[model samples]
Target: MTVATDTLQAVEAVFAERIEAATALGGSWALFDRDGVVASGGAGIASLDPARPAPGPDTLFRIASCTKSFTAAALLLLRDRGLLDLDATARSFVPEFVPEIPGDLEVDPTVRMLMTMSGGLPTDDPWADREESMTREEFSATLAAGIRCASVPGTGFEYSNLGYAVLGQIIERVSGVAFTDFVTHEFIEPLGLDMRFELSAEEAVPYATGHRRVEGNGWLALPFTGPGVFSAIGGLFASVTSLAAWGSWLAEASTGAERGPLSAASRREMQQLMRVAPKRHTPPALPGAPTPPSPVVYGYGFGLFVEFDDRFGAIVSHSGGYPGFSAHMRWHAASGLGVVAFENATYARVSQGAELALAIVLDAADRVAPVSPSPAPWPATLEASVALSGLVNDWSDVAASAVLATNVGLDVPYDERRATIEAAWAAVGGRTAASRTPVDAECDSPDHLVWFLPGATGRLRVEVRMTPLAEPLAQTFLVKVESPEPSVA
Candidate 1:
């Protein structure tokens, strides 16, 4: 999990770049490696109005949907205790919790479906028109009796906030404890995470105010109450440091490095990609152009978005957005890189911040190995150079656009964008360079490039690596190509 010194430096640079960019947009961010905090940035805005206190690392922000992962983990722990079965139907725990769908559909959503978001439940309850407060049981029963099944259970993946709420009900029925209490006892206290399910009136004084953009002016905070029925879905408020600790635990649990409340096998299962997400409908272009769907597929395990990266390996991530707050957490198991970003203003900046933080980590991974002395052989012909020049021209524009889109938090249009970037380098450098030799191709995959650029004194080098769909590419350019001197100072 430990990265090389050069890689660490590169990672730090990437963080600095992203933090600067994010702050320019008026947001705060925090990043962490496995051990602890590596970097943090931006002003902790005290108020969007007249008077308020600035936020800090310890500032509690509503983690929103990030709470689902915690709920999923608690359920998994209960399964390990032999008190629950993931494959068992939800009806086993609460028969009244069955969906109000056509009987001929024969759709029986399992506990696994609920946890993974494949339960065929609508994103929210159709019947619950009002956001009135209610007990967890009343909410679950109303949802079960009122919610319609849009598709067959386990047939498709649809993220359901209500599904997780149903899960909270099941947790209560199975564990015979309040959902929040169970989570605190089973997961929160065990990890020593400085987080709480709800903010008390007095405690709310230190919390950052959530904001939403208005017409002419900037942002305004929205008043929200503590989790009543939706406690398990999106109720937790936490700081970046606490979220980082949670991510680290998830990474350790996934890799079998640490055993928390859940067993290693169960944790690995949580990281497994189980279902492909349906193509996300493009919303009208926001401040930026419409974001293209992520290149990576979505999964249904532990309510997480799991994807494999060519560089950092497996990543587990989730994004949460509340009225005036946004949060994101991404953890790379192989590289032991964990990033968490939170913003008090609900400007949808959480995803952007997370992407920037991930870029930093991947950039570091790119520098893990020194560039080899030999470079890839070039085709010794002017025609080849001409052809490559055209290719590079086209690819550079594509790469630039792709990089811009990635940086600005837009969707990538094509899956081959990174490949094109690497191919562009090969085409351009392979044909135009005066001299070239085959370097180590071990790190040269379809998605990544790591090599040295020969120079008079030594060499100038570049390294490029792909990140998870949620993040941007981790790349480092103009790395000093060091060489042994010929017995002279």
Candidate 2:
């Protein structure tokens, strides 16, 4: 898909505007499609090093907890190889990970629990960020000593860095390779991502220094911490350019696109919403302010959050926060478009910036071409649609038996549907034609078909929804006139 030059400029303008609004010391951002970076840019300094380099598009910033998805991917790869069972007790892989429920209550959290952040571990960002360099021995010793729990294993969502650290151990024990080595060799290198948890000074020339900003003054620079044992959880340093590649791989793979280190199916599986995060009590968007981050009822997948917008579709994203670095990457499953942003300031809340940028990209794309839903995937759906299209003119046994959903008559009488559709057909040139909507296909499982027909006033819009039965049945059939009037009459 070719993005016009003007569209790219509009996206870049929105990105820069968000950055300036945030007043971040320095940052970089990029827009990505399923294939790779569509466009990338950076403003300000990457770091306060003596060289004082201006921000470069390829500059690396510690992705912090965003590394969990990489860790999740590594474990998923290992799971596919049958080296271990994800559903089995995590203690089976890391004996030190036995749940520390009170009164010797032994809760067996499965490896899956760790991946989904559902393990009984408490949230430990501040503590875990500093524990990046912990050795396998140190981790084992600490786990052996038992850990605190907020709830029972597999109970609910609680972001646990220690849980991911345990997963790193499982990867090491199962793959006979260090977690970093496993990810670097298996995912990073093969994906052509210039990514790492460790960087030598010479290689770090483009790295961003974490910052502590002081309002009305300046900011304090913090030295970057090299890779550590817990690096598996929140230790990656990546450029927006590199993350664009990663995000593109994930977005494309979701479409069952047959290219990537991991199978498209597995990558898509890793993105499924395994658990819904607890609802946050966030304030509503201010009347005139830039749209606040979409009110998120977050759902956790392998390492990322799956946010479903009633208007859009599934969005896969993760935010990283270390001492002085913050970052976020987000993508739409339907559009295969993504935004990646990184900041040097501590807890910079850059994720919101990425979110607002995403809203802008979505608006820009919609402006370019109003989106439409894809044709139904099930074979019967097309047959059903053809059969249902017959109803536009008049209802018949052939169309009803072949296409009508079981409840069509009970829900809305055929007389009403026929009149409504016939009027819409008359209003919209009195003829109907079915064609795909420009919108991206929804990456979901409900059988659906969307198309529009030209009309006199505006256009006649038709939608068909169905069940996934072998002989699928249309569940809901809608036909309406697209105009200021909201009613179907």
RMSD per candidate (Å) reads 14.7, 5.6
TM-score per prediction, in order, is 0.67, 0.80
lDDT of 1 by residue, 401-449 (tens): 4443243223333335435334434533433343243244334343345
lDDT of 1: 0.61
lDDT of 2 by residue, 246-356 (tens): 889988985778786788888998889998897543333323333534534568999888887655667889999988888889988888888998888888877866777
**Structure candidate 2, residue pairs in collision:** 371-439, 372-439, 428-455, 428-456, 429-455, 429-456
Off by over 4 Å in 1: 1-27, 49-51, 125-133, 279-294, 347-349, 370-489
Query: Among these predicted structures, which one has the highest lDDT?
Result: 2
Poorest 10 consecutive residues of model 1 by lDDT? Answer: 480-489
What C-alpha lDDT values do all the predictions have?
0.61, 0.76
Residue 236 of candidate 1: its Cα lDDT?
Answer: 87
